[model samples]
Target chain A: MPSLKNIAADLPPVQKTRRVFDGSFMVLLVLTLAGGVAVGVVSGWARVGQILIETFEFIAMLAPKIGAGIFIAATLPILLPRERVGRLIGRESGVRGLVVAAACGAALPGGPMMTFPLAAGLGVAGADLGAMVAFISGWSLLGLNRTLIWEFSFLPSDLVWTRYLLSLPMPVLLGLAARAVMQRRLA
Target chain B: MNILIGTVLIGSGAIWLWWQLPNDAWRSASYRASLDTFLFTAPRVIVALLGAGFFAELLPEDEVRQLLGAEAGIAGILLAIALGPLTPGGAFVSFAIGAAALKAGASPVAAIAYVTSWSLFSTTKIFAYELSFMGRQATLTRILVSLPVPFVIAAMASLTG
Candidate 1:
């Protein structure tokens, strides 16, 4: 199993001041301002007012779901420690390991800031590239938290389901493919 | 309707998990973590949602449809896949853009392609996190292996319909 606590401890310190207003947030702000100003200029002030009102209304509706998503992201790590998760996915091999890792990835909630670090820890935890790929791909394709709070809220339910079902088998397949490629290189 | 159901399901699951924590210390630690996460996440979420709103309005729907709508066919799907990585911001931005495009007449298959591609190849995540953590080769390997996924998913989605 991986000594994940050590790996996590080794990660570069995240500056609190830089957390929210960093490059990603700057990009978001710049784009939003550009879009808002563009719409105001081209579509008129009245249209801008209407869009802002609609945005607020939508936010009100989404508050509960958003709150729940936040809680899940917070509580999941405390409930399921990285060491335990590492022990589970680590030292395990083959198709079963990939499946387990994929499931863990899907179940784990958080953004890339959290997910990537945890994944890096999985390296020390004994997970091979296949398991690691399975984990990352699973989160990418089927993150429960994102799908619940974001995807279903935005897309039509049927469209979401169709895409979801279609994508469901993918992480495992990618894991298998990664394994094949690695094995080929080794041979 | 979907939002309500999802909220309830996720909320209850979270509560249940909290209830299952071994003791008061763990519960307190979890709560502390939640607060910290809320501090870190809430601003991002609010800003992202607002940004998504502005973007939805600014998107030239008619133009987007011309580029990625039903009549646009395979080419539209390909274009959407291409655009996924180019999109700036987080998941909300992409999903909001996807929703706007759908409303603006983009195909469902195209939306799937867009979301899948964004998940895999978003340059922000790639450069900032993956490359730094996983190194260049592993990152490239994942990208190379994952490259066909969105296109294949879009094709399969179309077939299923």
Candidate 2:
């Protein structure tokens, strides 16, 4: 297996510049408009306007938090750097490896486009299935960026905290579970 | 109150990261990147928030309560988990719907399960990205191992609550 640094270094830094108006945006636009129209038809235009006002007010409330979240998400990659994180996870093994992998997954910023590729590369970088599973699970369950920026913004804080705290140990447990199953197959 | 707490927490975090920028070049790059992200994110948030609001208004409280309320029990959580992967769009869509469901009387446990399920198994993330990047075997293995997560989390949350 290729070394983690070698594998990560081989992959070019993926600068995925998201289009402001993409397929997802178009879908959201249509859904929002359709929902608004339905509300108007079902209740009244007044209710639709009310919803619009409420949305904007919520946006205003969220602006500061969103601003902070964006800064953290953007700056995190620069601070941590890919090669260092890869090296850290790649060099370790057993539970320590899984812990490092989970930590990296949670701290690493970006969406699925960035994460999945990195995960695939880690697998090639000599990381085991346990580490790989832990990494993905951590990103999915405890990604700080998603939780702080999106989850907190949309969901109630109590619910967010409850879910987050509950999920804290899951990645490692899942990693161990994956390892056990794979080992059984080998045995 | 929640927003205030979140703002303070994230605000301090941002400030700390800014302090860690190390030099002028990095600061500029961070600013440019943040601006780009803001441009990318703002419109989506606005639209998704609107959709969420409208959908919240449209959700029949009676049905939501019947389907996913505290009274709905384990079946409600199962339904929530099932709805997660089927929901189209991104993080905001699932979160918005989850919030809407909560307003319409869905149990907190069900909401947690829905969000957890969506985070782990979003079809767009899976079929579009994970399957292509991680290949079928890795993806399938990950899915199989993770199949019980939402249910498990929901049960844990219920127990704690």
Which tens-of-lDDT digit does each residue in A1-187 have in candidate 2?
Answer: 2222232223223334568998868988998899999999999999998888888898888889888888887777656655566667778899989998998899777778668877887866778889988999999999987787678878888899999999999899989988988888889
Per-residue lDDT over A1-187 for candidate 1, one digit per residue giving the tens place of the 0 to 100 score:
3232332223222222225467787777777778788889988989878888888898889988888787788877765667678778987899999999898888899888878877878879999888888999999999999898899999998888988898898889999998888898899
**Candidate 2 whole-model C-alpha lDDT, 0 to 1:** 0.84
| DockQ of each model vs. true complex | 0.53, 0.57
Query: What is the TM-score of candidate 2?
Result: 0.91
Compare the candidates by TM-score and give the number of the best one: 1
Best by lDDT: 2
Candidate 2: stretches off by over 4 Å: A1-16, A184-187
Cα displacement (Å) at residue B105, model 1: 1.0
Error of 1 at A120 (Å): 1.6
lDDT scores of the candidates, listed in order: 0.83, 0.84
Candidate 1 regions with alpha-carbon error over 4 angstroms: A1-18
Worst 10 residues of 1 chain A by lDDT: A9-18
Chain B of candidate 2 vs. true chain B, TM: 0.93
